[model samples]
Target: MSDLKKQATSMHKAAAGLRAVGHRTAKPLQEFKAQSHDLSALGALGSLLSATSEIREGMTTLTKLTRQLEEEWEAEAKLIGEVSDAFDLLDVLIAAKAQAEKG
Candidate 1:
């Protein structure tokens, strides 16, 4: 396999792993949000809840970006395969040209 193809495969795997982690975190974040409402009555707890909400939003955005990256990496892997195929075809043509010259 070409270097580009290998790199694409690595990137795709990493993105997929990160996406899975994001999904795992999402459930906990939802639960936290649900439980946090009870603590809203406390004085300083309001600030804590606000910060947690912001963090949750940021996590949600990051998860979405991770999913998008995973899709992009998958597409990149396919493109790399196409490039490898093109290189193989070029190699065959070059070999044929050399053979014809020898004849």
Candidate 2:
């Protein structure tokens, strides 16, 4: 395989890892929100509830941004893979021409 293909493979793996991490993060964040919602039932914890709400909102935004980034990364990986394939084809053609010249 060409070096470009190797690089594209690495990039695709990294993007997949990022996506997995983001999914893992979402579960905990959702759990926190659920726990916070339960805590809000107690009037004495108004300040804490307010802070949790803010944190939840921020995390939600962050999750959205992370998802967008992951999508971009995946797209980039696909483009890189395509370029790598082109390079591989070019290499094969070059080799065939060189062999023909030798003949």
Candidate 3:
């Protein structure tokens, strides 16, 4: 082969080899990108789980508070009923006393 032709062929082969190396290098980058995407999905899933946990905790606290308020309401209603009955008894006693004095 002519010297110039052999030199050009050698340069071409080197360039082809470099392109192959570049392609090989790109494989890891692509894998890294895929892994990064999966990590992002995992992060999003973790955030969703955290949000759900917070909501569950809030619901539990609300349920407990509601039960406490219901108990307080029941107690207040019972006290009001007892006070009303006591007042009724006082009225009857007053009427009896007045009728007895009218004799």
Candidate 4:
């Protein structure tokens, strides 16, 4: 419920969404690369195929990084939630102690 937790949650959600998008694109990118390899028989078109292959490789790397980032974000969100709960508990304990002393 703290600001850090809220921001962490938002970041985690965004990372998850990006990771999903990356996953969705991976298969299509692989298919495109395979098809492009067949087009390599066209001589000049081979250059295009080569470029497409490079793009596919880049996409693969990006997808991997996205997945990693998603995991990190999720961990951060959990840590933030734990820290927030600890602070809330501390506040409650302090209030209780003050009340006990007054009574």
Candidate 5:
């Protein structure tokens, strides 16, 4: 419920979406690359293949980064949950101290 937790969760979801996109597009891109071989007669075939290779590499990098982001976000969320628990404990302690003083 805390702001930090929300941010962390959002980050995790975003990373997952990025990862999904990377995965989903990969097969199609590879298929396109394979199909491209049939177009060898075209003067621009070399350039097209080169561009496709670049895109595939970029997607690979993006997927890697997304995985890393997911890990970081998960860790951050756990830390935020711990901090939130600590704050709750602190509140309880403060209340108990007040009660003791009054008693």
Candidate 6:
């Protein structure tokens, strides 16, 4: 009966020690949970920034394409003028050849 009584006393002391350890450990575990929440918020912010940057890059690309189209439009306008001048020169040549053959 005395041995059983000693065992109960020893178990009670062990439980008290474990409780102290758990109390101390709980604060850091709570701090880790808060830090995880902070990290998750940062991740969401990073995704938004990434999306904004991609939109900015897309705008820049569109501006470059518009400039290239403008340049091509100017080049096409000049070619049209050259073609019109060539047609006029051809008409003059045909008139001169017909006069030469008639004389």
- Backbone collision count in every prediction? 0, 0, 0, 0, 0, 0
lDDT of 1 by residue, 51-73 (tens): 75665566567656756765675
Among all candidates shown, the one with the greatest TM-score: 2
Q: What residue runs in model 3 are displaced by over 4 Å at the alpha carbon?
A: 1-49
lDDT per model, in order?
Answer: 0.61, 0.63, 0.54, 0.61, 0.60, 0.54
TM-score of each: 0.53, 0.60, 0.52, 0.56, 0.55, 0.46
Model 1 residue pairs with clashes: none
Q: In candidate 1, how many Å is residue 13 off?
A: 13
| Residue-pair clash count for candidate 2 | 0
**Candidate 3, residue 93: lDDT:** 75
Cα misplacement distance, residue 94 of candidate 5 (Å): 0.4
Q: What is the lDDT of residue 81 in candidate 4?
A: 59
User: Which of the two, 1 or 5, has more TM-score?
Assistant: 5
Deviation from truth (RMSD, Å), model 2:
4.2
| Pairs that collide, model 5 | none
- Residues 35-81, model 3: lDDT tens digits: 53344444566577665455445555655565565556556555555
Better of 2 and 3 by TM-score: 2
Question: Residue 43 of model 1: what lDDT?
Answer: 55
Best by lDDT: 2
Model 5 segments beyond 4 Å from truth?
1-49
What TM value does model 3 have? 0.52
Off by over 4 Å in 4: 1-46
